[model samples]
Target: MVRRMFLPFYSKDRGPPRIRMQVMGTKGRRFYKIVAANQRDPRDGKHMEVLGSYVPIPGSSASSVAELRLRFSRVKFWLAANASMSLSISRLLGSAGLIPLPPPLFGWRCRGRYHELLQQQQQQHLLRESELRNFFKLPSPISTQLVERETEKPKKEDVRKIVR
Candidate 1:
């Protein structure tokens, strides 16, 4: 008997099964399609089935709540079939009590360090903005009223100084 080697992404018969929420829709609005697909498949590629859909942004409705539409029976069937979920899908499932909250990520992936870095970057960006504002003798970008007033009233002296 000969053993055949198969690639997980392309191999229909091997490896752990995965189901993911595939992002779709246009620029202003976006949504997701819950799909049973190979992990290696392209974002909009082949899907075995569409379990359901989720609309992150509401479509011109007065209600503020986000919409989540699911074929409950299909979801139950897929869960019984042992399909694993993507991170985002898992979170939704967790909130619905369909599954226990997923395990916490390792220490390195924790938010503290990432947040520190983000804060540092934002401070640097703000510093740059302030520097630019000072150099141009213009109101800081943070205040919309200041920006509007500054734009409406021309700084003739400042313009002359820059030209000189």
Candidate 2:
């Protein structure tokens, strides 16, 4: 008699697969592998395939840069295959212009290229404000407010009211 081993087959009912990060490396120093995995699988568990890698924290040297290496073609393929992404993975891909950014979460600080873009926008806003003020011949609000404050003295009644 001959015996053969059979592998379990995954079915559609298990839900769509996910493209997410699989944590690796030692304590206090960690790296991630971007992978395609089943949605129901535990984090850092078995994965279908690795798409890329990410190094969030680089070495202590000033010249060191955070690294994020991805195979864009493979990533696109998995996305087209209906793979969802974890929140952090989605943010990373969004920064690369792979897809629209996910909705902002409370208390999340913008970093990297996103922060630079925000700074550029703020500078543009200030420039536009100055241009509008100049075109309208409006008095500088700071100077006018200072002059008004120096000219007006708080009455004794106001002080008394506050003291009461």
TM-scores for candidates 1 onward, in order? 0.48, 0.54
Candidate 2, residues 102-155, lDDT tens digits: the string is 766444344445675567556666776777789888877323221233578889
**lDDT tens per residue, model 1, 1-164:** 21222232344454444668888998778878888776667778878778878776456642222766677777776676566777778866764557765655568348576666457557766877788788989864755221333356658998898899
Q: State the local distance difference test value for candidate 1.
A: 0.66
Best by TM-score: 2
What TM-score does candidate 2 get on C-alpha atoms?
A: 0.54
- Give the C-alpha miss distance for residue 68 in model 2, angstroms: 0.3
Model 1 Cα displacement at 151 (Å)? 62
- At residue 49, candidate 1 shows an lDDT of 77
Over 4 Å off, model 1: 1-15, 58-65, 103-164
Which parts of model 2 have CA positions greater than 4 angstroms off? 1-14, 58-65, 106-117, 120-164
Say which candidate scores most in lDDT: 2
